[model samples]
Target: MLQRIQTVYMILSILVMGALYMWFPVVEDAAKNVVIDKSEPLVLGLILAPVVLTLISIFNFKKRQHQFVLNRLSIILNFVLLGVFVYRSLKVSGETLVSEKGIGVLLPIISIVFLVLANKAIKRDEDLVKSVDRLR
Candidate 1:
């Protein structure tokens, strides 16, 4: 299954969520305080959701439908995370003094793209299976 393109996509998504976040700065405040990730509870949860879900989805090779479902969920969560990022960037507040934007802010979008590509591969595999079954 590791050889599968979808598996590769899911793995890349995991790296983005788990490893990349550790190194990249998400937002830099005007005071020179760099935030790699938001400390807010809900935001943290949303950030970790795809990491856990993608790991779970990767092992669900036998249950393609369930894997597909998990990817869909991950995609939705990423969208919500994106919205949060937007809100945080636009909000007029003291602590929300985001003077600089970083590449980390776009990680969720990149992850969503990976998830979508994985889902497409999954669907292709499912269709292939169905076609073969019909042949038999």
Candidate 2:
């Protein structure tokens, strides 16, 4: 199972997320001041949650159903994280507080795409198993 396509997708998602955390800024001001980043507890937690879930999903690959569930949950969390980024960028005084929205904000979307592909692969595996079981 570790060699499955879903595993590759999950690993790529993890790398994207890690890159986002390590080097990207979510929002920065005109003075190069970071407005939101890993330093913010809430943002940090939100970013980490999906990575943790994906890791769990990778390790639980033997249980396709469980892995699929974990991916779904990770997707939801990523959506929530994206919402937070959007909200921060759209604040009424955003012009003053956040002069630039960083490319990091789009990292979650990339992660989500990878998770969706992983889920699709997992579902295909599940269906194949079910079909084989039906034959026996």
Candidate 3:
């Protein structure tokens, strides 16, 4: 069912976000030795907070309105995170003249896409329930 899919997406997103947080210290240490700026870890945290919050919001899906609000907030936060990453990438690209590929880029993109799909599924579910109620 769509609800199950949404649940799975949320769980996966949560796991990914948590893993990044857990590994951040090690990553920061590694980055420090490199020529790149050390502020990447803070930027990563800013990008991840909404993802973690969105996963927490999934538990409240039984309350349709709340779920909708949470999903909207998640979407907004994801956009903000995306913007930050893009800006940072551009800034670094200008300075270094070479772009670095990292796990951070892919994870946020995947999480955002999944969150968007899950939000659509939630809306469809809500409409279906409303239609059924009208038929009663």
Candidate 4:
């Protein structure tokens, strides 16, 4: 099942998440080069949760409905991450707090795209299974 296309999509999602952790800057400031690393415990957890969920979904291929639910959950998590980025970009409390949006902010969007593709594939498989069941 790991050889499936959805698995590849999940792996790519994981890699993009890792790249965000390793080299990307989530937030920048006017004077500072980079403001926030993915290393913050909460940030790190949020960054990795989708990867974990996607992996779980990949391995649970025998349960297509469960896998579909997991993918939807992962998509919701990505949307939360995107919301956080947008929030950080909008409101500032102090001179040092001004948020400069970085290209790193786009990582969640990329992950979401892959997740959507994976979900689409999962839906196709589910449909095929249903159609086959009707044949017998």
For residue 19, model 4's alpha carbon misses the true position, in angstroms, by 1.1
Task: For model 2, name the residue pairs that clash.
Answer: none
Ranking by TM-score: 2, 1, 4, 3
TM-score of 2: 0.88
Off by over 4 Å in 3: 1-3, 22-45, 93-102
Say which prediction, candidate 1 or candidate 2, comes out ahead on TM-score.
2
**Pairs clashing within candidate 3:** none
For candidate 3, write residues 1-136 as lDDT tens digits.
Answer: 3356776777666676565455433222233433323246656666567666776677786876677677677767666665765565544422332333365456666777777777777788889999999999
Cα error, candidate 2, residue 55 (Å): 0.5
As for model 2, its CA RMSD to the true structure in angstroms is 2.4
Best by lDDT: 2
Decide which is better by TM-score, 2 or 4.
Answer: 2
TM-score of 4: 0.84
TM-score of 3: 0.70
Between the candidate structures 2 and 3, which one is better when assessed by TM-score?
Answer: 2
Q: What is the C-alpha RMSD of each candidate to the true structure, in Å?
A: 3.0, 2.4, 4.5, 3.1
- Model 3 residue 11 CA deviation (Å) reads 1.4
| Number of residue pairs clashing in candidate 3, backbone atoms closer than 3 angstroms, sequence gap of 3 or more or interchain | 0
lDDT of 2 by residue, 81-123 (tens): 8888878666535354444455667899999999999999999
**Number of the top TM-score candidate:** 2
* Model with the higher lDDT, candidate 2 or 4: 2
